[model samples]
Target: VNLLFSANRWEMASEIVDDLNRGIVVVCDRYAFSGVAYSAAKGLDFAWCQAHDRGLPLPDSVFFMRVEPQVGALRANFGDERYEDVDMQVRVRERFDDPRLRQGVPWH
Candidate 1:
């Protein structure tokens, strides 16, 4: 599933780059880091998650919104989908702090 997520992103790499080339602002709701975060939350090796996306085009910038675990679950409508629980969110949140990631913009 992680590979599929990465593949799905790669599939759209061209379009994203094209928009940038044309000076069109492209705001992706989710990107490569999501795959690593979600997969790592499932107990997969973080290194493997990253290796799976090696060579992918890095985004010019990314925005990561930090919220309390309980709030995140509530916002997720917890249980409506996988990884919506507080425990999983905690894991995902930690991985989001990976040093490989660049500074993220703030969002409420």
Candidate 2:
């Protein structure tokens, strides 16, 4: 499913490219980071998650914010979804903080 999620992103590649070409900024709620972090939290290898998302178009800027567990739960409205729990989010956050993920990206 993680691989498929990464693949599915490319399904909209042309449109995203076209929009960028037209000077429109694109905002993706979930990008490679989320794909990797979420799946990795679910027990997938972190490296494998990163491997699958390689070569995708890079964003001009990325903003990664980690909130407190209670904050995240409030923002996500706890129990409304499977990943809204504190435990899952903590795992996801840890994976996102992996040093490997910072090697080549401009993180703000």
Candidate 3:
């Protein structure tokens, strides 16, 4: 199915919301938060990354999968994914941990 090959596709998220609105208990494997975090990790503007997903139904709960970078890289390497590269992974980790994203931190 096209959906299988298009796992990271953002538009699929809208379809998911549509399903939920129709009383489907649609559970997303990765949703806007993950998309925003990953893309923003790659230097995308955080707000711009989120603009497309604005007003989507918020999840009733979230389960953050916290894993150490070393573990993540090993998992990624097994699949031949370069995103597990040590330096790049560190940047992605930093992107998530950066306090600039926290409330009350001045962007200026």
Error of 3 at 71 (Å): 1.4
Q: Each candidate's lDDT (Cα)?
A: 0.78, 0.82, 0.60
User: What TM-score should be assigned to candidate 1?
Assistant: 0.85
Q: Candidate 1's residue-wise lDDT over 19-84, tens digit each? A: 889999888888778888889889888889888777766766676778888886666357788767
State the lDDT of candidate 2 residue by residue for 19-74, as single tens digits. 99999989987788788888989998889888977877878777887687768777
lDDT order of candidates, best first? 2, 1, 3
Q: Write the per-residue lDDT of candidate 3 for residues 7-79, one digit (tens) a residue.
A: 4455466787788888989765765565566667777787776666556556776555667777876663443
Q: Which candidate has the top score in TM-score?
A: 2
**Cα shift from native, residue 5, model 2 (Å):** 1.3
Error of 1 at 64 (Å): 1.0
Off by over 4 Å in 2: none
Higher-TM-score candidate of 1 and 3 = 1
TM-score for each of the candidates: 0.85, 0.87, 0.63
